[model samples]
Target: MTNNTQNGFFKLTKFEFTAIAIIMISPLLFSWSMYFQGLLIIVMLWIILGLSWNLMAGYTGQVSFGHAAFFGIGAYAAALPYFHWRISPWWGLITGPIVAVAFGYFLGKLVFKLKGPYFALGTLASGEILRIIFGEEELITNGHNGIFYMTTWTSKLPYFYIAAALAIFSILIIRKIIQSKLGFYFLSIREDQDAAEALGIDTVKYKNLSLAISAAMAGVAGAFYMIYMGFIDPEVVFALHNISIITILVGIIGGVGTIWGPAVGAIVMIFIQELFRSSLFGLGPEWLSRLHSLVFGALVVLIILYMAGGIVGDWPIIANKIKSWKNKTEGQS
Candidate 1:
């Protein structure tokens, strides 16, 4: 990594800090409706997931298509105890990441052997296999019947606060990791595994370490989802398109390999999602909501074509274009 990249790893500008402060105090500042609060909570969850995916695929150059495997397992880690022994699902907040890291460790052993698209395919299959396994293992997992429980809080306030804290925590942890030597190792691996290994770096070991951290973060998000939503099923947690693909999009659209890119991506994604889901808050026709998936896909295509570096990644280019347009308009006037 260049000196600028290393320095930029954890350094937050005033604008970014202001945004963080606004999110931290959002509930206190505005007496928002429960619906809006719910949206905020979901956005925070995605922020965590996005950051998790970014750490592995962005920093470490290991593009995983099976994040849902960690996510679903984290959720199930919490749900199983609740289903079998009537233990509080809240305990999943602790066990979720542990189990996720364990699974990631073993999975890394198998998939890390492959490189590039093959690795991606391996991960994609792992998630699907877990989904099937969980669905079939009725004796332990309750099979496809799923797990249901009444949520602890009636209001969304507590959940929002918890989610916000987790998001902040995720940001801090990732920033710290990126500033350390491990972060450099990850960058080296991403740049070229062979070169990193030639320089005496243990590529496999570091890759596993990166995956562990990523898995833990995803696991925590999944556990939080289970407790807040008060329900979980194989399909909901391990859905290939919803969890895995959306996680990838979050990384890509936010500016993969950039520290704050995922955060920006999460906000954009959730806003777009809710806007369409509500059919422009009922202003547009109901059928407009049905096109959200199509719109999202098209947006991704546009981003890849024109904004390959992502919103944050390509901010300099975007700013320059805006500046030129302003100057041209002034000259014309």
Candidate 2:
């Protein structure tokens, strides 16, 4: 079992290296143009969001349903500076993460005592509260009116490159955490907090650290989002639905606890959404919008039931099993 796990890890590492290389070189190989650049930015944003959520929910086994609160906080942090003081968003990149980490620390302190479903409910309630506050505070957040970002000389390509760099950076951070001692601590805590504590692991500290890191990454993504869209509203940034959808779908479709799982899940979900929006629009039915959600929801359910290990996890297992079978057959022959 140890050997098999090690081999699996090696194979996954190689595959990740290759995939990242391909992604880095994609723009040079294919002309993405300007219009496609925006799409890439969106994909990269989702990748960052998915990866950050995976770090918290996947590895730590702390299912936070309210990550969108940090995301919204980051977006507002960036936008508020630019709108009020005419400051560059570059500064917000630093401030956003700081604010998010602080908020995450508070959240961890508040809810780490709770276990399982209670923790999830706490996060969900916190998210709802943030949404309500943002929506009601018209004087600060502009309420339902939203805030328009000031235009800059930076074009869509810069934003695309920025998003791509952030995605890569996030993946690298996750990969490092997974391979480090901290990862083992997180895994131990996930399996059994009491056992981990008995083994001398500081479960609370590690959990808070993981939460802070995850929130900071999400904040960075949200900060960039404000710059990319040049506008943000409480409805768009602080929406609980967005939080639930991204966290649930990414972790479910991708192999939770694996570095590349959430990223792969984000890519698949985004492509599916785009395909549905493009191809299903004129299918001669007014009810087609419902079909998209229905199909996606069904797919999520099936993935959860059959592929609990996630696409990333199961794909390698199946591939290795086939290979082993083939080798055995050849030996018999």
Candidate 3:
């Protein structure tokens, strides 16, 4: 994620340099269909969400089940201004996360009191609570009817670059944090909170800090969603299974602790979903799109059974198996 930093210069390994170059040149590399480009844009958003979740769950060990709370809040933060006050949603880029962080701080104060699965349950409740509130608050939030705005651009090109830049920014910021002393503190808490506390690590403060940072980044993604999609609803933005669970899947599928794992996972998951939606590129029956959810469920079961640590987390085992297969073939010859 981050290489060694020189005097105010961000250094990169060869791989890092190559990855960035590829991302930068993607538009030029292919004349992609807008549908394909949109899918890629979705991948970028998921990467941002996945990385944010990883910071809390993978790194801080405070697994959250309610990140949708922040995402919805951020979207609404932008939507409300445009709906009622007539301010530009672009300002939500700044104000949205600010609002989400405030709510995150509030949520942290309540949830940080618990640990392990209880912490996750607290977050789940938080997401539900927010969903209900947003659904019922018709006067302010437009309730379940949702809010709409015209997107800033009709083409996906501008949106892709903006999302790519934000995704990179999120990754680099997290990389910087992960490389710092705060990263060590987060690791300690993930490993053992009591031991961290015994070492005077102030587990509560750092956990809250992690939640704040994580929630804020998610908020940024949500704000972008409102601007890009131009629509928001409690069911869409604050859905527990869709937003919260999918974000977790992205992290786990990609490799929870690795820097680029989510990016890889996002690409893999979306491609699979899109493939199913397109019914195996129109070879399968037309009902295939309706079965994407079932496919996702099956994928989770299969991945967990075969690779508990996830694809990136268990890459060594996979590589060894492939190597052994190649060796066996050579021996037979």
Write the residue-wise lDDT of candidate 2 on 1-333 in tens digits.
113233322344556678877777665554546645566678788888888888888889898888898888888889887777888876768898899899989989998999999999998888788888988988877788887876564567667677888898888777767777888888888888899999999899999999999999989988888888888888788788776566668777888887778888887776676556555646545555556656677778999898898888788776898999999999999
Name model 3 segments beyond 4 Å from true: 1-9, 29-32
TM-score of 3: 0.95
Candidate with the greatest lDDT versus the true structure: 1
Give the RMSD in angstroms, all C-alphas superposed, for model 3: 2.0
lDDT of 1 by residue, 1-333 (tens): 124334453476666678778998886654558888888999899999999999999999999999999999999999999999999999999999999999999999899999999999999999999999999999999989999989999988899999998998898788778888999999999999999999999999999999999999999999999999999999999999999999999889999998888998999888887789889989999998997777778888899999999998998899999999999999999
Worst 10 residues of 3 by lDDT: 1-10
Tell me how candidate 3 scores on lDDT.
0.88
Per-model lDDT: 0.92, 0.80, 0.88
Which has the better lDDT: candidate 1, or candidate 2?
A: 1
Q: Model 1's lDDT to the true fold?
A: 0.92
TM-score of each: 0.95, 0.88, 0.95
Where in model 1 is the C-alpha error above 4 Å? 1-13, 28-30
Ranking by lDDT: 1, 3, 2
- Candidate 1 structure, TM-score to reference: 0.95
Across residues 1-333, which tens digit of lDDT does each residue of candidate 3 receive? 234543122566777779878877776555558887788788889999999999999999999999999998888888999999889998988988999999999999899999888999999999999999999989989998999999888998899899999998888888788878898999999999899999999999999999999999999999999999999999999999999999999888888877788888898899889889999989999999888778877887788888887787888898999999999999999
